[model samples]
Target: MLGRVLEEIEVNVLASQAWELYRTLQLAKFIGEELPNVIEKIDVIQGDGGVGTILNIIFPPGTPGFSSYKEKFTKVDDKKRVKETEVVEGGYLDFGFSLFRVRLEIIEKGEESCITGSTIEYEVKEDAAAATNANASSMVSIQPLVMIMEAASNYLMNLKNNKNKM
Candidate 1:
């Protein structure tokens, strides 16, 4: 059986009195389609709830995972955008070498969104080893999404601020 460990982090950002920008920008399509600096396109969206969306990506210097390729979103759902999005994601990485299961919850707080997120990552082994070691699958997971989240947050607030000023 595979074992699991947990990690969670919450980030709160204050924009110009509107949290929609922050919440909406977190969506997968908006970043790859609307944002100017997106690395690639969003091809597959997994999971029934808003918690999962996958983007076909190119290798960048800071991309996460055991390989240069990565899945753009591991999990995303902010209540500020749609009022409430609750879901959990569980999957394995390339083989028994790595695995992950994450849960993300977003709460709106008057111009700010309280994002409470948790994830469990561990080494996968046994029968799953060979299957995961193959070429990148159509379904992928983006690991270490901290930087993307930060950029999206900045873009959200700044874009709104610019629009309002004009």
Candidate 2:
């Protein structure tokens, strides 16, 4: 598999109903003037035939990308443990700065809640020879992705919960 391709995606559980928190964590790695480079911003735009979506993650110095994917917003079954949404985001950031294909899913226990569960699958199926930044990804490091998923899901659930309250 060396030279051909090695695909890896890690999954984990995030705090219940917390998307903004996850977003903050996602950007933390790119801040503080440390590491090989930095990440400035991430603009995630996702929407497609109720299945397709777009996510634009921007980096420092003006490197940005637009990713599109098909998503299924539902549960694993009828008696779903949670509500969920999944999207695949893939693209390049400044040639060698970044290149990856990621599948992200967020889940919540209820209809309108902040967040509860999440998963992130990222892999550089094809990294250029010049690209040196290895994909140091794990279900641990990508806790933020999961965290956001939980939050988003919970947010939806909470919205429903609030309506019931009203």
Tell me, by lDDT, which candidate is best.
Answer: 1
Residue 102 accuracy (lDDT) in model 2? 34
Candidate 1 global CA lDDT score:
0.41
lDDT of 2 by residue, 1-166 (tens): 0111222222232323333333332323333222222334434354421223334444455433332223333232222333334333333332232323333223453543322333433333345322545543321144434444334444445655686799
lDDT of 1 by residue, 3-77 (tens): 433333344444322234433324555556554343544445454333344434433345344322334344443
* C-alpha lDDT values of all predictions: 0.41, 0.35
Cα displacement (angstroms), candidate 2, residue 117, comes to 5.2
